[model samples]
Target: MTFSIVGRSDDGKAVGVAVASKFLGVGAAVPAALADVGAVATQSYANLAYRPQALALLGTGVSASAALAGLIAADDGPVSHRQAGIVGMTGPGATFTGADCHDWAGGAAGDGYAAQGNMLAGPSVIAGMEQTWLGSSGALPYRLLAALRAGDQAGGDRRGRQSAALLVVSPGRGYGGTSDVWVDLRVDDHVDPVAELGRLLTMHSLYFESPEPSSLIALTGPVAEEVRALLAAAGFGGEELEEELASWAGVENLEMRVVKGSIDPLVLTHLRAAG
Candidate 1:
């Protein structure tokens, strides 16, 4: 019914999951993670309780294999119908596919990552995902998304696609640096849920991702005048152009891409478009 990748960044700074399924709202039930703890994806008659319980176990210093074992041991449900993948921040990963799972169901685990799929087109679904995760570069979220997209290309859930999700966690990565809930976008229902999730992820990056200092351009000369005009048109301009621009960017939820003394190229383009 679903396919997913659970992983910790190679740099060990983040943990996340990317998943897609024929089932509606698979995101709500299949993925879970905690920064510096671990990530898990439970499907094939997913045990929702396995979410928090597995994270708790990982938080308590349990290995991925041990944590998954604990979850299965305590479960009284139809064990043979369950499928799961676990990856902890500091240990080898693990995966499971109950014998009773639908045909074409199984999984694989490797250093810092695990991938699993049940009722997939074939074993290539998980294999393509694993290959992508290993060879991909860039941020953790993109790598996870690439893995999911690779799975989809390999023929994802056997039935069809309905929903997809990406969950990432890192201390202080959330909005305003107030939480660990970084990158929690979901496409509950879409004809092409994976593609939709990718678009949402891009929007998330634009709105929430921080720009490098080197990427910022000081607002000066003609650029300053341009910014001033944009701010004035937006009814946020005042005697202090720099302060007004920052405030306006904040109001538009574009502050993360703008600096106090400089304008990010992306932010400048946004301001131009908005004005």
Candidate 2:
């Protein structure tokens, strides 16, 4: 009923999970992560307690393998029906597919990543996810999303897709640098949840991520004049261009991309499109 990957960044500063399933709201059930700790995905009659319990073990310095083993040992419910993947900040990942899980159920694990699924089309789904995750580059969220998409393309859950989710975490990576949750997007129900999840991730990047320093354009000369005109057209004109622009960006939920003396090209593009 589900396919998922649990992973951490090369530097061990980020960890996350991406999952899709025929089940409703798989995100809320399968994925859990903590910056500098680890990540977990529990499904196939998922015992929700496994999420927090595994994190607690990781917080206490347990390896992914040990944490998962302990959870299975302690579980009071039918352990034979559960599936999970765990990845720690500094060691190899671990995965488990209970004996009673539906056909085509299995998992793979290695340094920094794990892939697993049950009720899948075939082993190719997990293979495709692992290949993409190992070969991909860039931010952790994009890599995770790419791997999830790979699984979807490789004949994902035989039961078909109903929902999908992406979650990533890192120290001080959340909004205003106040939380560890860098990305958390979900599609609880959709005809094409994986693609929809990708779309939401793109919007999340624009609204929440800061621009690269090299992508910033100084707000002076023609750029400044153009911005002023655009702001005025948007009914945001003011003597203080920065202040008015900040206000406009706040309204547009692009405040995180706003810089005092410069504008991100993406933000500028949005301004022009709005005008």
Candidate 3:
């Protein structure tokens, strides 16, 4: 009924999980992570408590294997119905599929990733996820999303899909530099939840990603005049156009691309499109 991948970025600076299921609000129950700690995905009769407990154990410097052992030891319910995947920030990863899990259920783990599924089309589902995670390059969130897409294409949940989620954490990566929740998006119920999740991820990247230094354009000459005209047309009248632009960016949720003294080329393009 569920398929998931938990992983740490190759650089070991990010951790995340991607999951899809024929279950309602799987996002609320499946994935958890803390930057610099570890990531966990609990499914197939998932014990929600495993999430926080696993993070706490990893934060205490335990390896992924040891944390999983602790979870098994503390479980009062039947462990044979449960499935989980884990990946620590700086250690090997692990996955477990219980004896009582639905048919076509199993998991695989490698240096920094764990892919698991239950009630899946076949073992190829988890295999496709693992292959994508290993071969794909870029941000952890993107890679995790790609892995889920690959698994779905390879034949995802045997029962079909309803909900999907993506969560990635990195220190100081959250909005306004407040937390580690770099990307947290979900499709609680959708006919094509994985595809919807991908669309959301792309929007999130554009709205939150910082501009590359080379992509910054100085607000001088024609560019500066064009910006002034846009802001003025938008009813902005502040003496400092930079401040006005910042305010506009905030309203449009583009503050992450805002620079104090220069405009991002992407931002300029966006403004032009709207104008």
Candidate 4:
């Protein structure tokens, strides 16, 4: 009832999982990752314990294959009904499909990624994911999302789509650089969950990601005056323009794009729209 990709960034700095399924709240169950460690997607009679167990092994410097082996060894239930994909920060990816999993259930692994599914429409689902993961170019989150979308387009879980999720982790990439969860977006219930997940990713980038250096506009001249006017109109007027803008940004959740001497075009656009 699920399809997923677990992968590490080509630079070895990030790891994540993207999953979609007919199951409600698939994000809460199938995907797990740790910065600089590895990612796991446990489904098809998923043993939730496999998530932490796999991460623990990879955190200890074991390869993905070894971690998977350990998981199978430690399982007490019907391992034949389980399916999993694991990718460590530094090693070849690994995957497993139990003999008794639903039809069309299987997985594939390459140097830095694994693609897997169960109760899929056909082999095309996994094939599409593997092809996309290898061919797509971008940050880890984008690449993982592309693979998931490909799988969805090729025919994901035969049952249908209800939920989807994307999770990526990297060192100090979280909000305020205080954690490792760089991106965690979920569509708990949607008719088109994969596309909804993509929309959320775009929103995440706007609110959480920092602006590119080239995209910064100096907060002087006309731009600064415009911002000041917008802030005042929004009832954030204060003696100091920077302080007032900061206050407005806090309220708008655009603090991540706020700079000391310049403003992200997105921040300005958002302020203008809000005003």
Which candidate wins on TM-score? 2
Global lDDT of each model? Answer: 0.92, 0.95, 0.93, 0.94
- Measured against the true structure, the TM-scores of the candidates, in listed sequence, are 0.97, 0.99, 0.96, 0.97
Worst 10 residues of 3 by lDDT: 230-239
lDDT of 2 by residue, 1-275 (tens): 89999999987899999999998888989999988899999999999999999999999998999999999999999999999999999899999999999989999999999999999999999999999999987899999999999999999999898999999999999999999999999999998999999999999999999899999999999999999999999999899999999999999999999987999999999999999
**Candidate 3 local lDDT, 1-275, one digit each (tens):** 89999988888999999999999999999999999999999999999999999999999999999999999989998799899999998878999888999989999999999999999999999999989888998889999999999999988999988999999999999887898899999999999999999999989988988989988999888988899899877777578989999988888899999998899988888888768
Clash pairs, candidate 4, are: none
Stretches of candidate 2 exceeding 4 Å from the true structure: none
Better model by TM-score, 1 or 2? 2
Q: What are the runs in model 3 whose C-alpha is more than 4 Å off?
A: none
61: Cα error in model 3, Å: 1.2
By descending lDDT, how would the candidates be arranged? 2, 4, 3, 1
Better of 1 and 4 by lDDT: 4
Give the per-residue lDDT of model 1 (tens digit) for 46-158.
99999999999999998999999999999999999999999998877999999999989999998999999999999999999999999987799999999999999999999
TM-score-superior candidate, 1 or 3: 1
